[model samples]
Target: MAVRYIPYYPDTLEGQARLDNFVRTSRMLFYKDNNQVKTRIQRGMPLYEVTESETVGANPDGNIVMHGECLSTCAYLKDKGIEIDLVYIDPPFASGADYAKKIYVRRNPLVQKAINEAEQQLDNSDMQEFEEKMYGDIWDKEHYLNWMYENLMAIKSVMSDTASIYVHLDYHIGHYVKILMDEIFGEENFRNEIVWCYYGPGSPGMRNFNRKHDTIFWYSKSEDYQFNDKDIRIPHDAKTLDNFKKGLDGSGFISENYDLDQNGKIPEDWWEMAIAGRFPKDGVKRVDYATEKPWALLERIINASSNEGMLVADFFGGSGVAAAVAHKLGRKFVHNDVNINSIQTARDRLVSAGAEFTMMEVRDGVRLFRNPVQTMEKLVRLIPGLNTETNLDKRFWAGSIYDSQKGKMPVYLPNLMDSSSRVMDKTEMNHIIREALPDLGNDVKQIVVYYIDVEDIEELRQFIHDENTQTDIAIELRDLKQVLDDVVIEDKATWEMSQVQVELFTKWQIKMLTFHSDYVMKKIEAFNLIGDQQHQKKLANNKKSTFKPIKISDEGLECIEWLSVDCTNAQKDAPWHSDAEVKIDKTGTVTVNGTKTRNLWDATIQSDDKPLRLKVRNICGDEVLFVL
Candidate 1:
């Protein structure tokens, strides 16, 4: 358990000490705080329920899609006593790398302005594209181990005794995680260290062999785990067939019988496949998500590990490939991700598969900023004079702002990663007054705290005043909503609905006319502002640089990443449902329902139900609902 007995154990003293420190800290994680997830679950946590009564077709309520962090979703499932037959998670590789999604501004060719500009040969190719950080895999080794440990334990608690878990990771941190998995699932239950091999063009200056394969450590919960070898058999190669024809067996490695099942031979632990969307000619369907995996890889894993109608889960759920494949193969699934963009992408992907599933959220309170990394990144831009470049980069302090009148005020942004930290009550106030404020040093005259919620303002003030006898540092509280309110704008779009008959079938059709995303335009404006400053500097200094600014046509339907119509009647204060939808990728490729087409949009969506509400998601994941 201490990781001392690993193969080829480091003999050096320093290596041994580092490993000791890691093991020490990792064991401490056993007692680490989970922020009262168990207590919350005892108040009736819901596990996923798939209407698994499948006979001949897909069941709409037989699958589940969740919008939540991995831990919270796992906790919900474990609390509900839901058991998974197989799990395939392609989690972050912890390589300290940041991945981003290409954001595009949509073009509406049907609009009058777009039509006239197109007839006049307005070059749409000059439109610039930008990327938004989807997630960051920057984690300290010990912290990454701790997080992974917690997640694996939670996942194991929800797995059946005969279930299998395939953790797909690259070369960066897979070795360390394998040790943790060994501890959690037991070393004897370890099945295979599958190597998924692929080829891609590398730089000419490359000095080493390209990391063309990813490691997938397959572990079973128990010895009785399912594995249908024939489900994923490959055909015998020509050389092997010839050798068998000549009455020569290739020794112990090859089976004695050349009649090794006429169907084919079982594939080896290593697989030669292709990455998703890398080669357009390879014909892999893609959603353009930053870290999506290929479908073929998942199909083989699912086919081998789980039978038809078994429940599978992917908590990371990037692009929902695992869940989608499970549903396609007649298996139930639960897909979860914390990011809204990921959830939306997965939702659209599942819909295209005609999957019948209910969308659920981990009820761990409302998220103001949602994720920690992006929250800090946005705070630098959201707050005008806030600076994070300070020696006081303590745990609670978000950053500091220098004011001539007030001196230095350390800003406090709620830890979005922790649910209990979102709301600032007397408990949080006490922690700040006693713990966080003392560390800020006497130089800090005021400690500014921004909170999403407070139990009672008067009570909090009284508690702060009563508890502030030790420190003279004043507490200035500000509502996070007030600071972030102006930044969140409701996007505007125009759409209409009509009854269209297709092949004598009564269908409700909705057409997207134009869309204006303040989120997209704000980023574009900020981008252009930087360009303007560069232009001014160049004019003054007489220099030149290549920086293209983003331009948009009047009708901005192209900004719409995915649009849907809730043909299911929208009752009073009822939740929205996606009945018919269309998605536009970065290259302006349009995907309607689940069908991909190179034809012009015609800007229409059709469904058997009547169109009641319209939902449009911008490229940056900001959504606005319109009542039809």
Candidate 2:
């Protein structure tokens, strides 16, 4: 059997290796249990396939994913030659505390006290206390800055020559990220340290002053970057316009031969906009996500910074306000987040706002399109016992049918990414199933394909023929049932999985794997923390853990195969076997299946006074790794 493993190490390590690069046991591994692994793999597979199938387009060309890592977005979009126009990132405040959703009301004593004090001190009605608690002293400032800097580096490469980026932070990391942005986008393109004052208030008993504002650092790739100044003009109130008119001599309305009303005043750097809050008056139902930015704020920045049809990218999209506003205003937007729930919220918000798009598929080189939800459901129906939990289910739907459908018939399924598979409607599913049916035969009989693991093909055929030899064509379920009364279910084991067939299988597989991985990883981490010293040592003392081996999948194999055939940048970035070599103990050898690599761990060794720790270095940035 020809098998390929996704490389866990790079050919070379670039720059100095930091302890942070390793998957710290303290933090949950990306895929810990079979479930979590399955989810990541399954959810990720369809997306990966869809992305791989996309044709490269010049300018702002790329798919907008509602979920997944930020690095993946940069990698995906870059493959399509799509340099982003602007990236407005508002990542979680990185406070170690869990961010609870507000669906069920619960009070944090500390937060409550702070809010009360903020209310008492507010001298302006507009000044809200929410900001002071959430954005003010939330996280360790240094960690926020460092975490943000590392993530922003990935965003830096995706910017266009005429692009600009905005970093939304509070007094905490605003100034710090600003300095980092100055370094990244260049000091010359550092446009402004915009002060957004939601309120003008002061705490009466404070020693220094009361805080009532946030900051956004604007940076551009070049001095001649896109800034449609007129697009963000503030209409002078009737009085100011009248005053200007009066100053003009009458026909006279123009001492100079220029139209006055046509020109609006350029907005000042200090913007006084309403802070996003729970009140319905603020516009839209309040979403449950913490730190949701107001659409109005995004509107101002997007209008001033970019043009229509240009791409607007936001990686740290909490409620997807920026992406929602972007799509509403006719601009292409790509919003990314690691949290599935958050991305779903964004996608639903967009769908509700009436954006049109559909997932597509390409069967036998004939592209077909269908509704996203329907596509997912049809896939599930096709594969027996395969539900959304399987890794294969999502891949089968999203990769094959979804891609083909989106490319072929974009009309039926508008706006590809929808809510979770659980939320899809049956009506939508029916429409999608109808749309996705292969253009096989014209006789009205519904023919669905199945992929089973059984090895007896002749037995399966005989069983099917014996069972349903008298079946005939049918249109409706009622009609099908009439025909099925005489027909039999066929067994076609060992048949190749089609886009439709695989989509169904992959969904169930993905869910199962993700749940398994997440569960296992959490247990492993917890056990290491509280388990016996020897057990902890056993878990931690690894060149690579015995429990956690570097394993690659068939998808990974395909990516490597593509790389072998096509030396494209997209292929080069695919997860594959690592080619890098790191210094290791001559006595120790690390084994992955039949292959062995030098082991970095030793029985008796130290980096300085510390015991030998397995370290991985990537010389070439091609492989994806799992560390124990």
Candidate 3:
């Protein structure tokens, strides 16, 4: 049957125009590729190597944890021709809340060194900005819709034709997102609007009824999709069993000829599932993640939609309930999220659950050199009679140098490193020169080059000299470092590390361990103060503020959020086989002096392994894993 369209406010001419623009932008998904900074890194980045201990080895079906923007990660999967059978994303509900987790300082030497360096660089006021927020849920209605639309479009591209996707949302924007999902996945593919109702403490409100339920919109990629109804049946109580018997006609079962299966009854659209907080302290699967869903919820979704060995994915990956549950159910999974805290939490959870997954992040091989053109501006100021004009084409030209005696000379800043961060070779240099030739007109006689590092300076000069001779244009290669040294350019070159090391330490027993990482310190230094203040204020005002800012101490352990250790069997060939583990969930309390301090995690190990595998996650979700 065709979908019936009702005339709504958005159907009006003016509203239609706005909606059309949004749809167009969503289809194009320009935001994913428009991040120029990230694009540059993607063009030149390298994947971090999976260590021997982390590798699942020769298995094509092992799970994956990707730390990146979901859109980019989904696009990456699509480009790789990997299709997922099931995708369940619990994206931000646009609830206008800031989620955060408290982190502690690890008492490791490497971490201490980073802390010392940070203390020297930043003052007490700067340390106040170290609070880690997982992700912001606040968004302008239009912006949120457009962002979700683009991500959905990208996600749909990587889904198998027989795939199913469950989008978890709440009262705020569920209805609007349904329309967007219908447009992208087709109205015919719409399956169910599953209402996940839970009982929790409620407060009286004058405006409306208490909202104690969240909506999960299910959609299939095609008409033919997987639905294992038997796997997701709910148990029938004695009252229901008796009622069925009463309804039975002459036959021994319900109705005239029906037979009741031993398996439980199939669940209806309205489901009664408890939230994670309602679980007891010793519950089978309860992790104190702010937005964590119950494992049972994920289990039902995964079992009903996908079979064993089928690929499952969750891009939002909060606390990794879906991935954790999916692994336990014997399904291959891929989880992606931008928050380092989520990544760390999910990695630890999955590892402790005996799931083998490789961790990966999109990283550029060459660090982004800060203000390369600013150096050129400095050079023009230092040299006599040298004036420079900014160029329209930033890719090749930094600016053009103008001299009263000499004709306009174009300046080019060639990339010192190739896509892989290796020093540019002769052929690469020749290509750059060839591409720049057309832009340099007959009036232009000289081209100034500024480079940080070159493989062979003499060879490059010779190559440029030969090109100059052939084209009757002088090509001058100038070292950028030398120019900075000679002329005072108060600029520091900043570069991001392609790979960061994860430090692990074992205390006395196999059960106890400590972990430290410099990655957390780096994130703290890079955190934007303006954004942090806004986030802190938002968190403070909200009733859901579970995080308390830790007072800065000399130890500088404020960046460590949570840590998990999985004591895997050392004698066994499978590194992911866990014997026992400990999970440390830290929170801060105010001291008498009004100082917020976190309790240390002195874990008691239950396994026999001497060097336990530890996963240390910082507040931002970045993690470092090593043998302690």
TM-score (C-alpha, index-matched) for candidate 3? 0.55
Following a full C-alpha superposition, what root-mean-square deviation does model 1 have from the true structure? Answer: 7.5
lDDT of 3: 0.59
Task: Give per-residue lDDT, candidate 1, residue 390.
Answer: 86
Candidate 1, residue 323: Cα displacement in angstroms equals: 1.4
Cα lDDT of model 3 by residue, 1-628, tens digit: 0011111111111222223344553383222212322222233222222222344334477678886656556655755578899999998898998766544433333433465667743222322434445555766675577567656766787789999999999999998888778777878789999999998766765476777999999999889999999998878888678877687464345555666766987899998888863432322355546798987788889999999999999998988888878887889999887665567667666655657777766432222211222223345555544444554365666567776666777766543211211233455456557777666667877777655445567887787767645466777766555544663312111111122222553332332233334545444444545555767787888844333333333444344454344554443333443343334333322111112234323333333344455444444444445454
lDDT of 3 at 276: 61
TM-score of each: 0.79, 0.42, 0.55
Off by over 4 Å in 2: 1-63, 93-98, 104-142, 200-208, 242-261, 277-285, 357-628
- lDDT preference between candidates 2 and 3, better one: 3
Ten contiguous residues with the weakest lDDT in model 3: 1-10
Residues 1-628, candidate 2, lDDT per residue (tens digit)?
0011111112112343222333556863221122322232223211122322221123143346444445445545555567888778876544354443321111222333455667743222221111101112234554344445445655766788888888877765565556556545666678888888886567777887667788888888778888887888877778767866677454335556656655677788898877763322323344556678777788888988888888898987777788777876678888776554455456445544545322111111111111222222334344333324322222223221222222211112122221112112232233334434433233324333322111244554454444433434222211112221232222111111112224334210100011012222332344444435555577677633333222222211101100011112224334222121222111223222212344312111111111111212111101122221
Each model's lDDT comes to 0.72, 0.43, 0.59
